[model samples]
Target: MSRQLAVMMVLLAASGLAQAVTKCQNGSETLYTSASCPAGYRNVTGSMRSHVMTVPGVAKNQEADRAMSALRMQAAAQNQADEEMDLRAQNAFWNQCLVIDYRVRATERAMQTTEYWSYADRYREHADALRALQYGMGCLG
Candidate 1:
């Protein structure tokens, strides 16, 4: 049993010495034999290339990613500005309509028995004016 174990260990050492370990610089994937390594990859050991050699197609993908990120940020900023403008316009219109409604109601009360039809017409005209303002501001569009 001792002689057989010694023979097995020797065979293992011999086989290990016969193979060359190669590691790709691109992704650090190791290979048992140098011949099994892919064509575009170089060995980590002493070779004719620089250590910081970038893998093919990596730079182009990075550039595209950067451009896409910039475009997304620009689009988000534009959307936020548009939303703020709409909110400001809505608040202004609401305040104006409230004031107009209060004034018209007070006028109706003051002329309770006189010029009722004219007061109603005045309220309709104020409402039409508000609609026109909304349309011009692109709120209705």
Candidate 2:
């Protein structure tokens, strides 16, 4: 029992001799040492100790990453919406061009089949106007 007590005492004394570490920072550089910080370096050992020991600047970096991700997602959504709107506008323009082309074809047919030269001339003028509108609207291109 006496030997056991001596061993326990030695163990306790050894545990109590555990070295303390100090963290120091100078500008953007960091260092750890068993002694106090050197000149031009600030002691940051107290701030470095916490329940979880979260590193400094990590939390801020994570927040910035989340903000950047949100902005990228918003920009992608806006681009998709703009592309969809442009497609819809193009579809509408093509539909209108098809209707105008049909009208011009019907007028040409009428001009060819009519016996009255005056009616034929009117039909020709109407077809020419429709063609002009189609070209002006970029449908011919």
Candidate 3:
């Protein structure tokens, strides 16, 4: 996992004033966090740094899980319909590096049932799942 993601796991465990002091400064991404948990404030150290992706945000605690699951399910369905129609993924594009249709000549060595998707598909799917999880946890209604 990326250092940012790992730090997120730790930050998530912390809350209230404690979390407030645990800032992940990117010198770019602007985000605010709520001070509600009881862990108390303290500066976290040894967070990983990167040259490209600057992540910034705070994770909030939600009391309900079932409600979130319902909302996420509904959202996923809608998103899937939109995605299928668009034939697209967000983290990366659906590259046409190879022809999606047609097969080799009759003398071809062999053939597969369906063309393999670009490797980025897995990453995009993971991102979508994570998004659903975070959205579910952060929502109230």
Candidate 4:
């Protein structure tokens, strides 16, 4: 068992030093494909360019910017709702209610960061972050 453990440790160390995204296609030097890592580990999409969304049929330079703007709008509106709650507590001088609301919002926000957004029309991560941030802002209120 000791010998096996030593061998496994050696293999694990070797694997840790090598992490390469595979090529998107053979002979395609400019493009690289995303590779799956070990189980229970997720690749941060920001580190890899594989997930960039592009609309092939749309031939406009501002399309991407416009789409992003729309997402921002949605995120802002969604987050703003939570702020109103904070304002209410502040106006009423309800410290207990404010603290309780913030605690609940904080927990929800933490969970939202990793939650799967199925119906969001924009960047799901951005949407989640917005929701979380709004709740966080409420907590601080």
| TM-score leaderboard ranking | 2, 1, 4, 3
- After aligning candidate 3 to the native by TM-score, how far in Å is the CA of 20 from where it should be? 27
Q: Model 2, poorest ten-residue lDDT window?
A: 49-58
Clashing pairs in 4: 24-33
* Segments in model 3 whose C-alpha atoms lie over 4 Å from true places: 1-63, 88-141
Error of 3 at 121 (Å): 49
Ranking by lDDT: 2, 1, 4, 3
Candidate 1 per-residue lDDT, tens place, 26-128, comes to 5654332334467766666455233212222434656898999999999999999999999998899877766655665565555565556787677667656
lDDT of 4 by residue, 1-141 (tens): 635643643464355432344323223223323354444354443443433321222224357779889999999997897798779868765565465556556655654564555533234455456556546666434
Report how far off residue 139 is in candidate 3 (Å): 43
Stretches of candidate 4 exceeding 4 Å from the true structure: 1-60, 92-141
State in Å the error of residue 121, model 1. 12
lDDT of 2 by residue, 1-141 (tens): 635643643454355432345678999887765577999999987776332122234446678989999999999999999999999999999999999999999999999999999999999999999999999998997
Stretches of candidate 1 off by over 4 Å are 1-56, 112-141
Cα RMSD, each candidate: 13.3, 12.9, 27.9, 29.3
TM-scores vs. true structure, each candidate: 0.41, 0.61, 0.18, 0.23
Candidates 3 and 4 compared: the better one by TM-score is 4
Tell me the spans in candidate 2 whose CA falls farther than 4 Å from its real position: 1-56
What's model 4's lDDT at 122? 38
What digit string (tens of lDDT, one per residue) describes model 3 on residues 43-134?
22335333222223334323345668889999999998998867654322323211111111211212222244554455445545544544
Clashes of each: 0, 0, 5, 1
